[model samples]
Target chain A: MTESTLETSGRDGLDEQAGGQRNSAAPPRSSRGHRFTSYDVEAFEVPGGREEDWRFTPMKRLRGLHDGSASATGSLRVEVDGSSAAKVETVGRDDERLGTGGAPADRVAAQSWNSFTEATVVTIPKETRAADPVTVTVHGPGRDSTAYGHLQVRAEPMSEATVVLDYRGSGVIGDNVEMIAEESARLSVITIHDFEGDATQVSSEHAHLGKDAVFRHFAVTLGGDLVRVNTKVTFADRGGDAEILGVYFTDGGQHQEHRLLMDHAQPNCRSNVTYKGALQGDSARSVWIGDVLIQAAAEGTDTFELNRNLVLTEGARADSVPNLEIETGEIAGAGHASAIGRFDDEQLFYLQARGIPYDQARRLVVRGFFGEILQKITIDEVRERLEAAIDEELAAVGV
Target chain B: MATLEIKDLHAEVETEEGSKEILTGVNLTVSSGETHAFMGPNGSGKSTLAYAIAGHPKYNVTSGSVLLDGEEVLEMSVDERARAGLFLAMQYPVEVPGVSMSNFLRSAATATRGEAPQIRHWVKEVKQAMGNLEIDESFSERSVNEGFSGGEKKRHEILQLDLLDPKFAILDETDSGLDVDALRVVSDGINRYRESGDKGVLLITHYTRILKHIKPDYVHVFVGGQVVESGGPELADELEESGYVRFANKKEATVQS
Candidate 1:
């Protein structure tokens, strides 16, 4: 395997941790006034496109979308317990230093990731298990602006909590989240990205799983101009398990993409990933890329990934790519399957023959597609939110 | 006035090996207020006959006709056929997840009635029908056929029969997987569906246990994909007593012709 590397932009003066070869223009001196020290930034620096794992994603899309690159800090807020938890925070003191904050107003004018707001980090106390789900709401500032926020999570050993993040309002936004699952800890995360028709969204997730830990991630992308989720999970010890699930619906010029990577680095680890989405209207596109890897050192690993997409309309399109990489001579079980097909005409006809209208029959088909993901949610409130998100997406598409 | 008539019915299905024949030159008729039984072993074209009548695309009618109350239903789509008063209780009811039984029934009734029924009235009727089948009230809230046992699936099929209220229905071996208690519940549901006197039924099965409850007026022996013998209900008794070997031999001779 090729060595992973991370680079920093010298002129930008943003905190960057380089993994392999340092860039020639790299800045050595660090600032003390900032909450994040050089060591903190280094720990957060993700492997860029130089690594094989990040090759599928077009780096050009992230060229300017980093946390501190945007000019405007658009109106973004997270509400918990009937009050705003925090305002949208950025990495720079002025707009000139952060470039155009998030996305520009016009589609033609927006270039690369410059439309994203700065990354806002939200920290949850270790071992603090809350009774209610935390709600993070993102409201757009409208016009030409993009917002990016990274809610850093660390659930201490034996702690359990559920986080609900809602992306409402208008405009363009780019968000990313990095979650750390401590030893024997559990975390349930629900994220609903409901962008308006004209807005664009690009988000990423990097999670680390400790020994004997459990992590459940459910992402629902119901609305967006361009939505892409890049998520990666690595099991650090045996007996760790992760469930990565999502439900997405798009129609008419909307682009939704989910790229998932699950690395089983320890023996006796388990990972299950299932994502289902539906596409409607001409020119609508949905993409799913599932990469499951079992290293040679990790014997006795059981991993399975399935991505199924339903094309509700003739002109709508969906692409599913399921990749499996096994580097061991050991006979461990690992498999992947991907299917992209139109609605089952037989099923639709069967429902219709029972006196269901054509339109209602279509709804049932879509419902079945998303039901696979919705059934995994254990909390009632989260499930209801997912249902409402789906309903709103369907209504927006005139279904 | 609700009557089902199959006139010299012939149907063929296209397989990869080319077109094959399933239903070959069969004829039958069932008027309103009558129950007919079609008994045959597996692959005897019983289910094919039912699917052909319901307008399944796989079944091609080469040179026969199906008429319901003098209206030719062979040209209609499956949904159109259902709206025109023809229903088929599948041998294996499909499991459709995320679609509640109540929602499916209401939507089906709306399509057939040309207008959505009042929610209260529809719920009352569905509840009453489900009650007659020994189904709990919670059954309506579940996804259609999903996680339902074989017996529960069969009962749900009967619930559709009662709720859709089709003029003529083809019950395709609905009693095959039911126990004694479930068999009684299913038969009772079917009986209630026909109490209005405007419904006709063609119950197909391999066993005669279902006949004990539905009490068929006529029984036909299906062998070699054709009805080899037709008689009163006593024919079912004869088959139950002697088995289908004799009928199979007779069908082989007919094929040699």
Candidate 2:
């Protein structure tokens, strides 16, 4: 199909389907106050075919997400490391941007929104120093067929903190997190996306960087049926730095896509991104798109982006596009690279000649492919957990 | 006892003209516990001979056979030959990312034993081997020669030879990039492994510095893709003192005649 034709068809089908449901009826509301936003819920619908952002997504997956009449299931219990885990309390819901899961249309259209209730909003006080990493384990039981989670983080000025967010559940978890860094603050966020069988997940993170502040985000995706994650960052002041790193392994009909948007709004700012993916098995697909925008006002901007992928099977596929849209010519340098390739036969032969069997040879390749990203995790315990989880995933994929 | 026998081996590498012969009518043998060094100048096909014996796909054997322990190995895949106790300390060891040195050695050792090595034994043995080579324990955790200096990479190859104890090991220009200390350490590893009476060694090099530490039982001069002279260790001394210029001139003379 022509690219344009596919876009139009996909958008048209999504608009009609999602739009109709949004305009239809408001289901009987619970006593809980769910603040309705400005736009009609349906108006917030993403045009499947016409939208460039939604092009590669399977529109069918978003069906019934906006239908209030859609059945809701019991909530799953939270457990961490096999013990009862603290759940993310939803005190209030941002009705519009609640995601396709019955989120009011206006909220979804806001582009960027943060709403919550009874949730623990972790705040690092100004000038506070946290040497030991803080661990947040999110527990969700697949009790409900659909669920929503919202988390907020704020790092005060001149403060330093490390947060590890672990996701463990057997249900579709739609989570939205918003973080803001105060001037001169440093924040490191490590997210581990791991869920059980029969689960679909979608998550979005939005962060605002302050002058001279530093923000680092690390994401590791190992298990999910159809997982999509989006991270958007905007540097509001100058002299700040941002680093984003991610690694994803897909196999056994799994599909994982990560989209990133980095806006360099001020001069003397720098941003970097490196994401690597390994795909195996039949029909497994992974996509990575990084869109970096340098605003006209931002002079002396420096940015570098790279995406590398390794295809482990003939049937599996990976696509990477590092897109840079710069508005000024005064920038120091703006560059991007996207590389996709297969296993190195010479490296494989070397490993095997060392006496590593075929299966172990495959593992060595994967470990090497993901080693750098894993090292970037920063948090030792979390890194170990991720390593164990990756091993489990590799075994499940029959690697 | 293990034995390596090469019988009338003929091989070639792909080129514009298609399969230019690199090794023609070459024959040699090294029995258990013997160290044989092959010397030659550039373009003399020294490395090509090493690769052909190791079953490198790039060098197709037009004819001839390689036998390890009296079993034909010319037909074996590279890995198959390795499993049959053939090891190549490459002239240029390929850099493998993400695969840690320790994990790689353990896996290789396991494959050699036809079963997984005991975890404790592996850890101890690998650490001891690395220590003997003056390699830090952390080296085992680092990716296999991913960003190692030339000397470090060569030492890493010897580390593997220590851990993956094959019946026969071929060191192809293994001493080229080593510093004085690294050369000694590498030679020490080879000498230590010589305790395994049945192990044979093929040392392919242009320089004789490595021979000062690990004496070879036999030395051969390769010219025009074939070994033109074979003698005792004194052959290495002859090449070291006078160099391969005469041999190169002789090959040119032969090619013209």
Query: Number of the top candidate by TM-score?
Result: 2
Q: Which run of 10 residues does model 1 chain B get worst, by summed lDDT?
A: B94-103
Candidate 1 off by > 4 Å: A1-82, A91-202, A207-217, A222-226, A233-244, A250-255, A261-274, A280-308, A311-342, A375-399, B109-128, B136-138, B222-229, B241-257
**Candidate 2 lDDT by residue in tens digits, A1-399:** 101010000000111111213344332232111112332434445454444555666645532332332233434343222212212333445433233212222332232223223233566778887776666677654733665566666688998887777777766555566666779999888887777645666677767789999999888887767777877777889988999889888775777888887777699888899998888788777878787767676788888888888877767877676666666678888878887778677787787777666666777787778887788777677778877766776777664
Docking class of 1: acceptable
lDDT of 2 at B152: 87
Assess each model's interface with DockQ, reporting 2 decimals per model: 0.39, 0.47
Could you give candidate 1's per-residue lDDT for residues A88-176 as a string of tens digits? 33343233422111211111122222333444444345565655565666676564565555455556677776667777777655654
Worst 10 residues of 1 chain A by lDDT: A1-10
| Model 1 residue B136 lDDT score | 93
**TM-score, every prediction:** 0.68, 0.72
- B1-257 per-residue lDDT for model 1 (tens digits): 77788887888999999999988888899998988999998788999999899877788988788889888989887888999888899888877767787778888888988889898888788888888888999987888888999999898888888888899989999999899999999998898877866779999999988888999888999876678899999999998998887887877788788
